[model samples]
Target: MEEAIFSKLRYMKKVLLIGGAGFIGFNITKFLAENRNYEITVADNFFRGKMDVLLTDLVDKYKIRVVNADFTNAASFDQLDKDYDQVYMLAAVVGVKYTEEIPNELIRINAFLALNTLEWLKTAQCKKVVFTSTSECYAGTIEAFDYQVPTPESVPLCIDDITHPRFTYAVTKMLGESGFMNYSKVFGFECTIVRYHNVYGPRMGFKHVIPQVTQRFLKKEDPFKIYGYDQTRSFNYIDDAVNGTVLAMETPDVSGEIFHIGDMTDELKIEELIKYIGELMDYKGTYEYESAPSGSVSRRCPDISKAQKMLGYDPKTSWKVGVKNTIEWYVNYINTGGDVFE
Candidate 1:
């Protein structure tokens, strides 16, 4: 008789990481690999993620395994093991402006992947699931700062009622969260939701605000040309987000509960952030400011009280520290003339 799938792991703790090659996924997998407690299996398709980011040398050294797969493909699902103690779904077409332009494709990919995972999760006996959702699922606001930042999970989602441009990303995220929650309710999967706010750090795409600013500065051109000076976002360090995700997984009562994960203390302005990056890079360039696009939010901050209260989650990395680290990575990447996409 054939051995049961995941049976080899009965004597050892193991975790399944979907999209484990992405920025956040790579960091989480790296943490798990170093701790050496859990055998890690990472599945990714390299869509928005780069395979090189996971560092094959580290993978080999740590005995981490990778499966080239996309969640949308049924054949891909066939390759996945039927048993895992924990499952983390971090696969999605990410980014705000990028997701906005391709709303239909975004919805289809996210929805299909959620459904596919639901099927696989039904057959697999896992202790808990960590699902990453975005704060974009929250309703659009005219005054992000005047109102409580980091809107809580209890805040009503306004995606269904909006006719605005940014709603494309918002609506789909809401649907994805709903699908996951429903499956957990009916099928009894222990699920936890983390709505991440502007998660950025090493390995993140250069297109994100921080990297974008750094890149422009490195090019010896104006770094503040792209958007309005008023726009703002509370950047959450990737490590902080990863820690919160693991915490969510560990907390048993968080089954079917949603929490926003981000740094609540800092709210940096876009123009100011750019200037800071330029200073870090020591770039002498003209600051050319422009009006932000229509879809840009004036401000966005996470209310992380629930995360702190429920899961004992707190962001230890300050914005200055996170930015300094990100800037250092950008400088090295630029010095080597490494292609961000490569």
Candidate 2:
């Protein structure tokens, strides 16, 4: 019986994770390697998320293959195996900071990554593809058109102002959504889209609000500034996001479908989120409110009912529990003087 079990493990599915070095990709890779007998290959450029000790440990433990290449270049896909059973396309320049600083570069890199990968799939023998996306693609629709809260995937994507640098990220994602669905239909590959909503956790680097807030508190900012304090968002813990993503990939007969993978439990205000983080950090500082920049959606949350019904996706982490765990990790990481992010 044990020999039979080992035999099954030896012939597990071959999975390829493009940009798997990043936060979401890394977690997904880890989950699959430990929880399932998957022949995993992580392809990454490490432009934003670095190959830190954690990912190195996982690769070593799982015997996973690592391909280091900038996927922004069209020919880079050749370095990867065309026979992968599954592909997770998570490569892209993310974060609001990048959008504001280098919108043109964001558009260029993201669009090319999507297009190049699509062209590769046209000939590749992959059975299914899961393309990671963000809810920002529909931010303008909800804000401008007053779309339903816990916004569904059916909400038409909108660009409040194409000229605004922030919308550049959304524009490229919109292109990926349209391009991948259409390309899959034409090219005969199973594809699923999971739009992540405010997914956050430790080792996600210092770009996001939670980490930024922790840094400010640790720096002893006497007057803590809560930007977009009144604006609200529903935060999805990384574990929930990873699970939903895997479900979208593994579930049967779900091709050409879009699922909003996020937590709809708490639509907390920005000020509320920051204060909770501050409380965890034992912050006794004063607080101030600041305005969100242009093109920033005032309110956003995904209606995850579709994912719940179709994929059996349910978010299990609460803001308090998730925030506590995240704060602990960042605090320990900072206190240890780890220069991994640098």
Per-model tally of clashing residue pairs: 4, 1
lDDT of 1: 0.79
The per-model lDDT (C-alpha) reads 0.79, 0.91
In angstroms, how far off is 35's CA in candidate 1? 1.9
Candidate 1 per-residue C-alpha lDDT over 57-139 given as tens digits, one digit per residue, 9 for 90 to 100: 66788888888877897668888777777889998877666555777787778777777888778777776888888877663
- The top-ranked prediction according to lDDT is 2
lDDT of 1 at 304: 94
TM-score for all predictions?
0.90, 0.97
TM-score of model 2 vs. true structure = 0.97
The stretch of ten residues in a row with the least summed lDDT in candidate 2 is 333-342
Tens-digit lDDT string for candidate 2 (1-342): 999998998779999999899999999999999899899999988897687889999999999999999888888888889998899999999998898888999999999999999999999999999998899988988888898998999998887888899899999999999999999999999999999999999788888888888889999998888888889999999999999999999999999999999998889999998998888889988998899876778998889999999999999999899999999999999899976361
Supply the global lDDT for candidate 2: 0.91
